[model samples]
Each structure stands twice: as structure tokens, then as C-alpha cells.
Target: MFDKIRDVILEYVELPKESITPDTRFLADMHMNSLDIMTMIGQLEDEYDITIETEDLNNIYTMQQLVDYIEERL
Candidate 1:
């Protein structure tokens, strides 16, 4: 699950793969704006065939958080 999430993040962002750690914050560490985040969420939804509730979006800040959320839903 981490590898899959990492792959999507690597494809979406310009950051080097090695730079992304579980602790990496989406905005602060990865340099992602709102649009980048939305796009990545969309891609994740498509990949998993699930919709991330709008309210849940607020809870996801770091790479670990996002991966954990998806893993829980799975």
C-alpha cells in the first residue's frame, strides 16, 4: 500500500522519490498546492474505486495519514 501510494505521489509531484517519507507533509514537504492535492486525490479514488469523503480530506496532512486512510478503507 505504501509503495502504491508512493508511486502515485511520485508521478504527480516533481519531488525526487527519495525525498518522500511517511512524515512528509503534503503541502510543506512536497510543495503541493490545493489543486495538486485534489488531482492526487482524484487519481487515488480512481485507482481504488472509492470516493474519499470531503470531510475526511481535512484529516489527511502527511503521507502516512493518507496511506493509512486508504488502507483502512480497503
Candidate 2:
């Protein structure tokens, strides 16, 4: 699941796989904009077949958080 999430995130960002850890920040570290985050979220929703609430987006700020969110839904 982590690998899949990483892959999905990579598609929208230019970060190296090595630099992307559980603590990597989507906005601060990756320098992602709102569009990138939204696109990543959309991809994650489709990939996991889950719905991510708009409010929940703010709570997910790291790779681990995103993975945990998906795991919880699954």
C-alpha cells in the first residue's frame, strides 16, 4: 500500500523515491501546490476505491498519514 501510494504521489511530483519517506511533507517538503495535492488525492481515491473527505485532507500532511488514512478506510 505504501508503494502504491508512493507511486501515485510520484506521478504528480518530481521528487526522488529515496527522498520520499513517511515524514516527507506534501506542501512544505515537496513544494506541492493545491492542484498537485488535489490531483494526488483524486488518484488515491480512485486507486483505493475510497472517498477522502475535504476536511480530512488537512489532517494528512505526510506519507505515513496518507497511508494510514487509506489503510483505515480499507
Scored by lDDT, the top model is 2
Clashing pairs in 2: none
Worst 10 residues of 1 by lDDT: 9-18
Query: Candidate 1: TM-score?
Result: 0.90
Q: What is the per-residue lDDT of model 1 for residues 12-59, given as tens digits with 9 covering 90 to 100?
A: 688778888899999887888888788889999999988898789898
For each candidate, the alpha-carbon lDDT, in order, equals 0.87, 0.88
lDDT of 2 at 19: 90
CA error at residue 9 for candidate 2, angstroms: 1.0
Q: Would you estimate the TM-scores of all the predictions?
A: 0.90, 0.94
lDDT of 2 by residue, 10-58 (tens): 8888888989999998989999889989988888888879999989998
Pairs in steric clash, model 1: none
